[model samples]
Target: MADIGAAIATRMDVLPITRTHRRATVAVGLGLFFEFYEVFLAGVLSSVLVKEFALSKAALPPLLASTFVGMFLGALLLGRLADRFGRRGAFLLNLGFYSVFSLLGAFSPNAVMLLVTRFFAGLGLGAEPPLADTYLTDLLPARHRGRFIALAYTLAFCGVPVVGFLAKGITEGKILGIPGWRWMFVLGALGAVVVFALRRGLPESPRWLQAVGRTEEADRVVAAFEAEAGITEQKPAAAAPVNEPAVPPRALLRPPYRRRTGMMVVFHLLQTFGYYGFGTLVPLVLTAKGYPVSQSLLFTAVTYLGYPLGSALSLPVVERFERKFLVIGTGLAMAVFGIAFGYSGSMALVLVFGFLYTATSNVFSNAFHIYQAEIFPTSVRSTAASGTYSLSRLATAAMPFVLVPLLEGAGPNWLFVTVAAAMVVVAVDVAALGPRTTGRALEAVNTDGAPVTAPERAPRQ
Candidate 1:
């Protein structure tokens, strides 16, 4: 077992993340950014769409909810496809699906058409995050996995500012006689073109190769990575031990991993309620509070800065602490700060609270992505993450329609208070049940009764 672990780690470590890998990372990152851009643009363009289509506030939720419904189906369906087919094949097909639908979204003539297009676009978007997370995690060395994952998320969020800035600029100044709001979908489609081009050069993940019984192809891919990194002597592949029982997904519901998955799902559920509630409804909330469009966009931009800022500050801590503890601590902090945010009237206080809330919440966000993917075996990693992540999306999709009514009836403070309380519950669950996965190998962190060692650090490149 020790030798097997070492061999896997060595294989992961020796593979150089060369220029090609870097480009692959960038392509995948850009793909994620565009996915987010499509989702978030609705927040920026809500009022415009509402007015242009002569729709009421009640109409907004269903439009947004449709996307997540599609995403749920996509993740479940496409995730299984990735598992059965291959990562590269699944990724290319999904990207093409997204690109075509996004472009068509720009041509939607009515609310119904737009909603349908967005839903399909979301299906394509849904597959990318978990797929990208799985692909990137498999490609990088274990020691650098956390940082690389952080970088991917950071770059993925670059779309927040880009969407905000573009929406602000174009909406404020109409371009090419086209409605600025429509350009959001148009530009998102254009971005997909870049993703498509770069993806053509990406090699298949070596880990995926090994899983599908293509051992020679896996060796060559790993060897290429090793050669790029200048590591000549390769570690011998581990012989399969006799009578090793196949670990089923049901095992994840047993001892160590059961607790881990439950904690993660609960944490994500609460966080999604808060995050999607606040994030998706920002423009509507701001408009209700009497902020102008430009100011709303500006404030949204300022608030989202917290995501990247939080990611940067939390990277060091992520490496130091057990992922479960980090999630609990950050989640508790977010709950406290979120309440303060709900009560504050001053704009400066709101922005301050927003920044702090985003920072703390994202620490949990970044950690969980790495933690969840690590907890499962490679055979079902994408399935687990995608399926689990889709639950958060489902929660988020429901929030706008369900929570918005409560906010309107009871007021913003009550709405936030409810969300904060949920966060508190999540924090407790995670603290009690979450497993330690700070420095662990992906293969050894299984729920099955495999006697595993503490994950070792990968050699620095």
Candidate 2:
């Protein structure tokens, strides 16, 4: 009887990736693609936009910084909104807001107007990434959650290469007698149509509904999932109870979560600084090395090819390693390879190092992406992840203007070294201060079971 009961419980918990879930994932993935496309396209299209508007380098920083400012406000404000409102509502609203604004941005008459539009568009885009992470994590079984997160990110990173190819083709080729840079925004507008279509079928997160005291809605959503997966209802298995209260943002700041939140903020901030510093500025670095625009783009494309591959390969290993150690080790590897790429004069060496850098970064990224979502309860998961991740974006926002200047003044080698050193600092802090989260249910990491305790800080090396 005990064995039979356990079997029934297992059946209830392990929902298959049904068609609805798959469709929802794809839709969310596409929405994320557009968001990243906006952030990344700026680098590739900067030269074209500048020429079209007769804008100088001095004008570009403020224009770019404007979007970051919007993103910062959006993530902090809208993240809380998501926690208060339903994830589905927040998702649809954000999608509509960004899509429409992005379309309008395509028609901007001058740099100033473009900046303002992009900034507002960025505000909408900011809400999707963390919300998507939380929603998807809640849908999957604990065993498969890491792989699902990696796969979602894999699909999302495809945007990097897609944006590059699109920028290259449209900027070089005229379509309907309109310049390619203009077509980029046109495509961005089309992304809204996709978002609308996808949202029609996507379900609200069941865990989220339960947290907000909408237990009936949560049960109905889970019922739909069960029916789709061809499973019959059974009592949920007895698991360790989580200690978190079913409140939204406030829960994140309470006892166990407060430590988790603080650690994540530090981890994400350092990682973002390194990730965007290289990602956004790779073309610039190549250009500085005397590579022509075409060659630099080609190199950037080649370098990014490793991102999805790394993420794909990480899916299996994600479950096997301690999340904290995996993140720390991968970060150290990213730093090592990043510095090597900066110092290498030979193109072959540069490409090799670049590939390794992207690969290691993605490994670290996929691990942390899964880690952050698992650390909080459903009530505050999105809020915590978004708030922490927004810090990274804010850090990333400063990279182009502040870090780029530092790179130019100190040279690329020094820039790489600085990033490497930052990663070491992050890795040690994480290793010493972070907790193991692998193979655990989301509830396990919260205060419900064992009161979450802060790990000791890494001793200064």
Candidate 1, residue 406: Cα displacement in angstroms equals 1.5
Model 2 backbone overlap count: 4
- Per-prediction RMSD in angstroms? 3.2, 6.3
Clashes of each: 0, 4
Would you list the C-alpha lDDT of every candidate in the order shown?
A: 0.73, 0.75
Model 1: per-residue Cα lDDT over 1-461, one tens digit each: 43433354347644546766677777887888887787677777777788778878779888878777777778877877776777887788878888888889888899999999988988887777888888877777655677777777777777776777777778765678877877888888888888888888888877766665666777777767767767667544332211122344576577655766676677667778766677677666666666787887888778877777787776787767777788778877877887787776878987898778877777877787777777666666777777777787778778877778977887777777887888889878877776666655555555354434433332433
Candidate 2 similarity to native, TM-score: 0.91
**Candidate 2: lDDT of 19?**
80
The 10-residue segment with the lowest total lDDT in model 1: 237-246
Candidate 2: give its CA RMSD in angstroms.
6.3
Q: Residue 187 deviation, candidate 1, in Å?
A: 0.6
